[model samples]
Target: MAGNFKMLAKTFYGFEPILAKELRDLGAGHVKEGVRNVTFEGDTGFMYKANLCLRTALKIFKPIATFKVLNEKELYQNVNRINWPKYFDCGKTFAIDTTMHSDVFNNSLFVSQKVKDALVDKFRAVERQRPNVNTHDPDVRINVHLYKNFCSVSLDSSGSSLHQRGYRIATNIAPINEVLAAGLLLSSGWDGETDFMDPMCGSGTFLIEAGMIACNIPANINRENYAFMHWNDYDDELHNKIVDASLNKTREFHYKIIGYDKAPSAVRKAQENVDNANLSEYISIERKDFFRTEKPIDAKLHMVFNPPYGERLQIDVEDFYSKIGDTLKQQYPDTNAWLITSNLEALKYVGLRPSRKIKTYNGKLESRLVKYEMYAGSKKAKFNPDGQEAKS
Candidate 1:
């Protein structure tokens, strides 16, 4: 508790609660959920752990300054007042990202330009040299957020978004994001209690993430980079200690994580990704159409997948969803199936009303994560047309 500071973990929409729970479980203090982010208290070592372990976090930011700004001049002066040289060296490349939700600034780009000018001017006046801007891949990333005239400037600790978990080397046409996959699994209450399956696993993101969660493995175990690594006060020894501590917490997972893909190419790519993540021991991939195969295990199964939303894949959306419903009803008994899709109209054809429908986003497209329950014996004996259970 010597150097405890507040940190914010950004996540996708509707993932605030799940991300908050993840932070709390990781021993964060005073964890609070915001719109699409979570705020918590942690020290420098904990920050490294959060960056390396939080599966739902997009980026972890350490806020250095907060103020009320009435105009552009005030923003520049306030940002310039901070000791920019203390955070990073002049030789390191940096990038400024601005997000505005206020009428005071019509263009976010203009705000970013002003902030950059202030930072560079501060560095030039103090250190006699300015850090060059590298928008493509920066060593340092700064975030400026404005909401209703209030400005919060933070230093981004995680670069390139935490979704780039480094395990997914091969990608399919529209592979689900690793963060999104992990969030969905957590949202579905997956605790490694039973066997897991991703019937239409593309690039095996869900399988890899599920395996990590099951085994308590650090989310970024395969990741090699973080913006904090370029900071002036980066302590390699502290970071390594944190990594070893997290690795020491790893537990054994007894269940299987299975993936199936109809396309041979997708199966190969998913297997490659699984191997890349070093999860091949827990996850097994096969080239088999999900609709044609019954449940591989008789015990209760947990399923989460992103079926082709008919975006890049050539298929009849309505018929495909119908077959999905039919197959789940006819084959996969005693299973809980969840899928996310942006095609709402096509989703209606699934016939079985979802027991739960959560509004979420897949990238920029608004989507729904729905759950369908398959009974063990007779499907009609338990589920009604409305997705509710039938009376005894």
Candidate 2:
């Protein structure tokens, strides 16, 4: 059994608090949040569990070494000192990735090359052979982070991004990233207590992620592989136990999760993804323009989705957003509607003052997750009847 060690879970911008909370809830000790990341103390089993269950983390890194270095030669010497053979053998295909914020290193690619040379040299000297470099798909991934004069090396526990939850077989145009979808849902305070919806659900990512959250399903239940499985200290039995334990924690969801898409192709893709996730029992998809469809149920509804950003879709940005506001105001009452969009210029046309405007990102586009509280009657949108944003 491995002793407890400090690890970092990297997340998207503005999700550091969410990831930190998730880590703490999952029994991580000494949890602390950083910029787009959270550091915590956990043992090997906890590592497996974090990778298996965390919905917002893009990757989990187990730091092995930290060194002070001012020059490339020092960097090489420090990287060569690590006992690489104890982590992974020379036969394992590996890749070195670098991230830095330092005047000492200007080119990250060059830094990666230098680190790779040092690692390969160490292996060759010890075993008379070296691992092959596999950039596309590697059995082992080593990360080097340089901040100022300090360089930290870590082993990427999650092979691919945890967002690749292995259930999305089909994707519509501009399908939201799975991790982002889950984070947005969680940030919206979605707990599966009431009916849920994604009116413009693209490929059903929100629906599936919402279902998983509602039922307490592990976010990566369908994922079959991780980078930790290839390490020399991989423990299959412990990993199996972790998976089983997580599965046992899933609770039954009594509410409904519905998705609506106007496009037939998107509807098919969302259905395919839902089936792949084995969540068809909890989620249903329909083909209908959201502006034309009313709320699916008469209960309190929780809604989250990413609409066409006008970046890719050739729609009237103002009219589309206005229609969204109109639908929420007229069609969906007693609903908490949240949508993420990068078109800040167009968001003004919604004519409704969002109660909460959280800063987030959709890929490279800086976006906002705005919330529209549609009460049953007079407490609805803040839009004036003559189509003007009401004074706060």
Candidate 3:
């Protein structure tokens, strides 16, 4: 049955295009990018594939209904009008999460409460049984998005964020989100053909994701559960088939992935995470200060890392960044280094002109993913401190 339905994949800012491209590649139809979200059409199997393969998506939402509501009363009525029994049984536990961008709705909690009441009433009115609300770990999670007078009700297919790929159990003070790290690496055109390094690898997230991307491994291969698995319409056989098919597409990677951290604790944590991801064969971690180390590989090296931004790690911001610049300029030749940091003022101390800078966010702090390319050989790399190219 080719039942076409709309689904929205939510992602961090600056990742909608990547998410949309992922959906398109995964056999989705009518792929369209929106603000921090990508909407697409796919059948049930395709939905499972998207939840498993997408590297940048945080959540995949299957919107069951959309309507216009001027006030809470209308919202309650419309929520009750939905065929809730079609999605789940009354014995299952569910949760309602609400987001509002309307002036009329002052409280999202209130909206969620109303929607829950509507659902409970609908189920109880017919079968004399109602689904209990379990906020922490629900069998089914529902999303209600209200933009002005419009409301879209969706069922979350990806549970607890796809960033929780069920591999990383250890982390440092400022561990990067797995999805964000993967997206940043993809944005930098990492195909895993060359040697990859994360000089400040906190917990080896980039290394693991890079290995997965190189080997064509599904992003959520290690994940044990998703919200869709608990739905009444979930097809276990279809999901297993999708998993096997995706596994069949796995390819071999030839290059090495390495991680370096000055802190011994960070190194240990990274190694533990790498082992958990079962990527120890492709990745190596060392407890060495990036500033004191030279480029390990003579060939073109691709580096992506989230260095200390002074806020998380207690290090001198200006001097630390200056050391980073000195290390890269003196020791790291024939390399392209990419790093994300929230400290704009500290970035100036690096004294090297970033050839490329993309605006991104690390949580609430606005940051930039900057790139410095050191040409391989006697050709000296150019550094424009002002970010403008200087005439020869």
Candidate 4:
């Protein structure tokens, strides 16, 4: 515990608990959930493990400095006082991202510029050179958080957002975010016990994530890089050992994971992405219309998917939703179907009452993740007010 330090794992809204549970399960100390982030204590090895194993985390940050600042001058002085050379060398390029929730700083971009100037000035004064700023792709990324009169500076351990798992080489027009997909699966209580499916599996994001969750595979097993690798104190041998240990802990999953997409191009892309993730054996993608298909398995099925919200994919909103309800009620019984949709007005057209409705956001669009439970037998299945099996 001597080398352990506090770290924050940022996530999407409603995912704090999931991320906290993941950290605690991975042996993190002092785990606490806050809004869209979770803070915990871990050593360097654990940090590596967190980056590799956290399915719901968007990014991981190691806070290096926290101080009080009243104005831009104090911010510049405090930021410049830190030993910038200790983190990374002048040869490495760096970028600063600032987020401010304060009355003092009106523009976050200005704060970022000031922080960047301070860091560059410090490096120039000491080493006679400064790291270049690369906003697009930086070797090192620093995060600045300002609230009221306090500032928190952190070093980003995960470079590109962890959602970019590096396995999704091919994506459809509206592929679901990997973190969101995993969170939805976890929220649905999907522990790989029953058969899993995504009827509208655009790029197989849900199928692949479900497979990983089932098999206890590290979420970023296919990811090849992290910002920590470029840090000054990074230990390659330790990182490799951590990776090996995580890989060795992967358990075997023996349930079927299937995906279906009506479009041939989506089917091809989903298969390609699944293959890229090395999970083709666990997941199978078929080019078939979900409305025309019955349950692929006779046993209980757990379904999670992101159907078109009528924005990207054009369709008759009410008719499509009604078809979804009809298909599940009449054809695909014994299934717990969960879907996220931004079209709240259209959700009423689904006919079946949702057992659960959770508030969530999908890229600025406030959405609801709803669940419809279909019983095994026709007599047992719940029907709408119309008293019809498959209502129009």
Query: What value does the lDDT take at residue 30 in candidate 1?
Result: 95
Compute each candidate's TM-score over C-alphas.
0.95, 0.95, 0.95, 0.96
TM-score, candidate 2, is 0.95
Per-residue lDDT of 2-67 in model 2, one digit per residue for the tens? 799999999999999999989989999999989989999999999999999999999999999999
Clashing pairs in 1: none
Q: State how far residue 276 of model 1 sits from its true place (Å).
A: 0.7
- All candidates: CA RMSD (Å): 3.9, 3.8, 4.4, 3.4
Task: Report the C-alpha lDDT of model 1 over 1-392, residue by residue, as the tens digit.
Answer: 24899999999999999999889989999999999999999999999999999999999999999999999999999999999988999999999999889869989999999999999999999999899999999999999999998999999999899999999999988989999999999999888989999999988999999999999999999999999999988999999999999999999999899999988999999999999999889999999999899999988999999988887787899899999999998889899999999999888999898999999999999999999998778444667889998863
Q: Which residue segments of model 4 deviate by more than 4 Å?
A: 379-392
All models: lDDT? 0.93, 0.93, 0.90, 0.92
- Give the alpha carbon lDDT tens digit for every residue of 1-392 in model 3: 25989999999999888888888888899999999999999898999999999999999999988999988899989999998988889878899999889867989999999999999999988778998999999999999999988999999999789999989999888889999998999989999889999998888899999999999899999999999998888999999999999999999888889899888998999899889988999999999989889989878899998988889688899899999999888888888999999999988999899999999899999999999988675234455898775543
Worst 10 residues of 1 by lDDT: 375-384
List clash counts for every candidate, in order. Answer: 0, 0, 0, 0
Q: Write the per-residue lDDT of candidate 4 for residues 49-167, one digit (tens) a residue.
A: 99999999999999999999899999999999989999999989899998889868889999999999999999999999999999999999999999988999999999999998988
